[model samples]
Target chain A: MTETELLDALKAALGADVLAAGGVGHDLWAQVAKGRVREALQLFKGTLGFNVLVDHTAADLLKWPGGHWAGVWDPCQATQGGEHERRTQTDGRFELTWRLMRLDEKSGLVEGRAALKCRVSDGEAGPPSVRDLWPCADWLEREVWDMFGVKPNNRPDLKRLLLYEEFKGHPLRKDYPIAKRQPLVAPLPAPEGRIAPEQLRPRVTDPGLVE
Target chain B: MTDERDPQTPGPGSGALTQGSGPPGVLTSRLDAAIGWARKYSIFQYPFVTACCGMEYMSVASGHYDMDRFGAGFPRFSPRQADVLMVVGTTSQKIAPILKRIYEQMMEPKWVVAFGVCTCTGGFYDDYATVQGIDTIIPVDLYIPGCPPRPENVLQGLMLLQEKIQRQGLHPKPGTLRPPIR
Candidate 1:
């Protein structure tokens, strides 16, 4: 399906959930409803056959003017064989993207991407866990929770991944100070020559002078 | 009682430089050259990838500027057989000990190449969780600096290791300071 046709289908199916639909760079990104992500993604998968989940990663949406942005790539356009033996014409293929992709070789591929805006708040519930759909999403969502304080609800493991268990705040958020330094680990008796006293030794004067 | 030496075996004072003779420096140098050649041609490495720079490391190993041509192929899983440790990613405080253990498990005469800004000097994460530099725990032989260094820079570090091995014969430089040899 063409980009416009796919967008129309999404709007019709999702109603008020579809925010903005326009070409962004080489692909199409739709500002979507925060709660309707799974439904919108299922529509793209079931109707258009965008069955490949290229990658799922979250970006600090605060970079944008509106909200947090999560990106997912669709490999529905992937084809088999040489040009002469092409299975189908995918010259200017449209990648239908949401937040997830369900893989099934027999049905062919449909581009799917889903993005939901998240509010940065200690009080805000994390984005719903999509581990049931894509297991790797478990880690991705936990990272978001740990880095941005955006909790992914129903997540089995919500502990921090990049920071120590005692780390108090999410370091990636805009409000988090860039200069805050955590207390240093207790020194390890400094490697021999690195300490002041040991560093004073003179260099060996002969080639045969073993340490 | 001292045993008499055979006439054919020559006396201890003889400046004997024949095959299977004393002072194996020549033999050792030859062996070092061969190992040096192997080290240059095929530096099979186990990547301790952990952060953003790892992506760039993968790019170097993949297409564009394939490192495989020079024999520095990336092996994800660490096996004792691999001698070169390419710490291409960040090391956390929790993971630092693990990295040290992995380094120790590697056979002797192993070389470590700290790739990218993080592994080289902790990049900008001078915090508690992330290790400031891998060298703090493991002895690093080469440091490649870049926030997320390009593939060419990684290859440059590999070449630098090769040059060091060829010139120094992979033996620690003589009289270059050491912990008093017991």
Candidate 2:
């Protein structure tokens, strides 16, 4: 759908939940409630003609101070050289960002973005799994889990993504260390001589422990 | 009745032969040395590739100076099989310990080749979550300089490793770099 049509449709469907709607260079964005995300996006895809699930990711903008939101704004519509550009609230929460490309054939170049502020459980836990709607969200969700330590419920593989298997802390957290590592044990030596035994030897240290 | 003039030419009887002065000795000894050298150089790496600089590390293994041709094969999935630990992307403080454990799990004589700017010096992410330099925890052998170096740059790092082996030799010494305690 056209930018105006999509914005109007979201405003009509979600009402007060659709916080802001606008276009930024070659892209459009709409801020909505977490509860209305699936339905609102469905409206955009089924009715508005945005078919492709271009991308899905999340950002943690926690540096902003309290009681200082200039109304929720979409980065896609953020202007480059505006005299009245204001900073939006960057509170420590998962701002779920999605990019949708219009596929009406005639209006295929148009793309839209929608940001939903998800209620992070325990103040830092990630959003609920979007895997049921978007299967590709699995990798992206895992990444968010690995980096931010944000656990999205029902994720099949919530283990570390970029970090090692035994990594301790989440590196992408706002408070990761400058330089440090937990203690590690050296590996045992390989068997000597040519004929390596068929049976494996037990490791010297506890295999359960991180090396 | 057999022609003895061209000994270099393989004959039915001379199944195993060599042009060197010495006899064809034990094949097992040669096989052992070959295996030893292969294990020494071709360290199957498990690159925890993340961020921008991982691209440069991939180039190091690509065509031109292919790492596979020179012994360092492509990365492996299991840490048990891999001999070298290459932490290619930016590591956070939380993940630092995990990277360390992976390094520790690699068998003895294992080497770590620190690739790119983020890993070697921690580059722009020298902040709270990101670890400044991975070398602070693990002993780094070769540090390739670049924010995201070219693939040839990785090959250059490999060549530098070969030079280091030529200088220090492959076997670990008493005090070269202390192995992890127990």
Candidate 3:
């Protein structure tokens, strides 16, 4: 299926959940309701055959303007509803994105490419863990958590992935200083099975020098 | 005491310059000079290669540049058997502690050569993740400052180290300023 057909199928299946949808070049993206991300992914995988989880990542939306629709035309201004739902997310601070791919089994080719995005408020928990859906999400989610401190519920191992254990804050956060360095610890003195200082060879081995 | 010098041996009490008897010339020299000469000519190097600078180190050891001509061709993989530590690359913050441990494990009287700009001052990697300079972890003898330093520069650095070894007194501190030998 083509990207447009995939978006149409999404609009048909998840009518109320897809807030805004459009194509960016050949690929397409759908702004999904924060709570409906897992449900949408399940639909894409279970029915539409978008089995390949291309990559899952997130970005800090700290730079985004409040209540301003970042689309081709303001979907909120065109909305007939009293108050557009997209205009009410003044508190939304992070944009979690998931790129998925549909692959043809017989010809071994890509059938479709689609992206799903959801805005998460600053204090809210991250989107549900997709480790069960795609095993690669295990580390990818952990990395997101490590860098952004966005906790994903039901995640078995949600600890720092790239930074050391003692690292204080998520370094990728906008508030985190770029040049800030963490305290480093030296290794323990004299590990087990290490050769004793005296047992090691003498420093000088020159024959001409008399001790 | 074994016939007070064998007939084949001829010299003035073992300290004289002999001619035409035992291989022509027999000249005596100070014990210090002999030791210095020997130590300078045979440098056992532990090349702690970690980054791109290792390519230049390879060329320096290769036949064209000929590090063997200066007695630094055989790079001892183990730190225990080495007299000189030739650190030849960028050192990241993650590897700094390990580098420190290696430096500590090496025997005393060892000299450390910071063999590239990265090892010397972290090169362009002046950030939180990369070590600013290896000297922050261990003492350095010679700093061969280049991105990966040319073969000629490395040879010159080797010559400087050799001179340093020659000038040093007994119980030689390889890189420090020791008092003049009496």
Best by TM-score: 3
Candidate 1 per-residue C-alpha lDDT over A68-137 given as tens digits, one digit per residue, 9 for 90 to 100: 2223232222321211111211111111123534345666554434332322234555446666665666
Q: Once superposed on the true structure, which residue ranges of model 1 sit more than 4 Å away at CA?
A: A24-26, A61-122, A156-168, A179-211, B1-90, B100-120, B123-129, B138-182
- For every candidate, what share of the true interface contacts is present? 0.11, 0.08, 0.16
Best candidate, DockQ-wise? 3
The candidate that achieves the highest lDDT relative to the unseen native structure: 3
Candidate 3's C-alpha runs over 4 A off are A43-54, A63-90, A101-112, A185-211, B1-24, B27-33, B55-66, B174-182
Clashes of 3: 0
- Least accurate 10 contiguous residues by lDDT in model 1 chain A: A85-94
**Residue B67 local lDDT, model 1:** 86
Error of 1 at A200 (Å): 23
> lDDT of candidate 2 vs native?
0.59
Residue-by-residue lDDT tens digits, candidate 3, A1-211 = 6556777787787887788666543466688888878888888888888888988888886765544255337433454332333422335787788898888888998877888888787767877888788888888888888888777766645787776777788877776765566636442334245465359564324243122
What TM-score is obtained by chain A of candidate 1?
A: 0.58
Candidates arranged by DockQ, highest first: 3, 2, 1
DockQ of each: 0.07, 0.08, 0.09
Worst 10 residues of 3 chain B by lDDT: B12-21
